[model samples]
Target: MVHQLAGRLNSIDPQAGEALRIVSYFDVLIARGVGLDGLLRGAALLSGTVAGAEIRGRVTRRDPDGHAPADAADARRRSSPRSHDTWTVWLERDGEPGPDDDMIAERLALGVYLLEERRRPDSGIDAIIDPNRSAAERAVFLARHRTDPETRVRVLATPADAADTGAPSAIVPTRYGLLKATLDRSGRLAPPEPAGLGTWVRADRAPESWDAAIIALRLTAPDTPTVDATDLGAMLLLAQAHDPQAPHEDVRALAALDQRSSDVLRTLVEADSIRSAAGTLGMHHSTVQARHEALTATLGYDPRTTTGRMRYTAAALLLRLIDPITPARTPSA
Candidate 1:
């Protein structure tokens, strides 16, 4: 009977024969309770096709269910109407024509699901974004999935006050060998604005890369569409330390000043000289100089001095991190 079935499959298409044989092997492995790693490898080997294969799963905003992994048959029996996670098996081939695309794709998805249920501890992005996951766990999970040294990860995050309505976010890797060109072209397209936060880090450092991505997102100007983690300097460190309710003594001091006064101090700290500061702010050089003197009197130090510049820069960074929404120049002072 099996031989007859195989003969019939081959008569229809040689590819169909191969697909059935692979599916049959998957069934046997499912019965034997093989892991996802085993099932995926076996299927790829049986087909003797596909350059690469992987299971891509959707990321839900919430945690996934804790049900044990089940075989393809069980998955068919107990499929749910609503799933927080959905997965599909992706097969890649350079140029060879596969026997049956749709049929093999479906069977591969089923096999992947069976093993993935057992292997995956939690949903992908959910685990990364979850505050409850230890740094160790996040690093481990992210590193495991992004094992390729050349793969770069990008993250789009918004400030707490920013609305969530924006361009949709994507977390998938770029198709091999196209990432750099794709990234370069992204900024030149219509709408002509930067898009999202991006970072390039070794796969092992995913957690740190994510941290930088989020920081860059917050530091970026509202008009700019994208920000790279590498461009951020001391701002990254300051953003990391920011806690709105717990401003430092110097930060509080800077915050208490009227807008113009704070702006003048911030400008002085950032500019190369008083003349340059005045030029940037469109203020008279003497006016800036006078404000600098007054700031020195108010803060008990001259911000133009070396030590004062350091302190003032720290305060300015804190202000930006904690109150990024406020205008840099206020007229009230």
Candidate 2:
């Protein structure tokens, strides 16, 4: 029955696969018939830890109807039509699992419902605008930053070339392997303008309201690189399910199984060898030389130097894509 229930629950939401994994992890505990309370607590703890979130503790007694307890009922309600908590809040709270394995089920439903509601409203810009002082503040900022030079100012200045201007300048090569920007006016850069934030945010801001703040908290890292969590997690889970205790050796073996070219490149990079990387990786020396040569041709520099390493690192990330931990998140009340 538990297996049947789990199979049904697993199919409920693709996004909540990780939670299913936790359930799978505790399947053994459940089958042991260690009492409903013990199983739930075990599920909760395992789910919380791996999902990097929280779940409710165990429930002592079953509900009157011989169904899941009342708290689970309330939780299901809250997660569905009456989800009061935001995404961040939902993830952070220690909500309990319902008696039925409907936690992941409802979360997916709620997500789809909310998405539909958003589309239905179709409020567009009006929905997003702060409605209060958002417009006023923007106006004020524009008024200050707006410049009025006597001669009609160039409304939009094509980026300047200052090497001739005699000021110390740095020419940044752009994506197309061309000099893109020349940083002429600056003082050691005011700690790199974080790319993710914009004018919508305030200078003296509540960290919660700021894009950078919310993002910094929610994200795994500044440059964690976005991924389809479901796919990555599933891959990780599949690999782990095959061999949980042997992750290291298994991962290495799995990594080796990746596309031939990528594996060799990664192996060479890790070993810091440019020469025999081709032979050991099963590619011809000429092919390796051509790839190496083209690496420079495409990126516009030598691969042995720091500039080359930057290109190599970028490629390496794609080559060494880590199999996800087989479920990005977990579920509960």
Candidate 3:
């Protein structure tokens, strides 16, 4: 298996030789049923060829001062998420590890392979990251990192511009999939396609972080060329509220209006002023005013009012959930 992987890695680029060897060592330990914690320890030792080499995963919360929050793992078994997003890997030797452009590409590709394997046993990397090891092994692994400050959890998401790639195995046929990568606490990322970022956390919280990462990926715009979890913002909140099966009453009401009324109402809501809406819709000011009053009567609220505006906006958001591809404002009605 090592020889086969070496050949494939060499084909991708000769530089991958070192990484492939590391992965191969990991593979051996995995086949021996050495748990993830053991694999990480082994990786740290293997990377010792580099000066002061260390390998560890961290769930980092960055502060405005360009620092990470103090280690609070002793009092916590989970992440106290604040601006909570992205998981990162630290591969350091003599200097602070960082992901430059080239390193980002490498990590992104590796992450994609690892993520696929996690879902199903597609390659050797799968065995390395899986958490379901024997109780003894898991205990041993936990013992090794019990004092570590970083949370040992991960979040994975795909970037917008993923590419077609083959599976990690040399003989497996290639297929298209999102490229994924792990980010660091410093917010550095490799270019991602099936892009994702992971962090260290209490073992139990890993799945929650992973779910958030998936939500971030779903909110990512298709036209967005790159992926970053930090940008999810309120979109994540909306994602939490989004219910595809729920009846969207306001959205339905908006859709039920006539084309001119719908267009006029949307314009009024967007522009905030009747005159501006009239200019935008190319209708007389009085005509727009009349439509606005008519819409208010139909919807039982004046759209210009704050309460009405909130409903309109929420309905618009709901409409997006319903038919995201459709324009925010329908044509005619």
lDDT against the true structure, per candidate, is: 0.49, 0.32, 0.44
Candidate 3 local lDDT, 1-333, one digit each (tens): 345546766787776755555444443553454433443345334433111111134433222232333644223222111110123233332343422322322332233233334444333222123345443443443344342223454545443234323222111111112223222223343434434344344543443444455444443455753444446555446645766556367777875777777777878988958999999999899988888888888887889988999888767655544432110110010
Steric overlap count per candidate: 1, 5, 28
Error of 1 at 276 (Å): 6.3
Could you estimate the TM-score for every candidate?
0.43, 0.25, 0.40
Ranking by TM-score: 1, 3, 2
lDDT string, candidate 1, 283-317, tens digits: 99999988888888888778888998888877776
Model 3 ranges off by over 4 Å: 1-149, 152-156, 159-161, 164-186, 190-238, 254-263, 298-300, 324-333
Model 1 stretches astray by more than 4 angstroms: 1-123, 129-152, 158-199, 223-225, 270-288, 324-333
Query: 2 or 3, which is superior by TM-score?
Result: 3
The sequence of per-residue lDDT tens digits that candidate 2 reaches over residues 157-273 is 011121222322222111111111211122222212211111122322211122221122122233643222223332333322333223344234334443754454455555455
Model 1 Cα RMSD, Å? 21.5
Q: How does residue 107 of candidate 2 score in lDDT?
A: 31
Name the candidate that leads on TM-score.
Answer: 1
Q: Between prediction 1 and prediction 2, which has the larger TM-score?
A: 1
lDDT of 1: 0.49
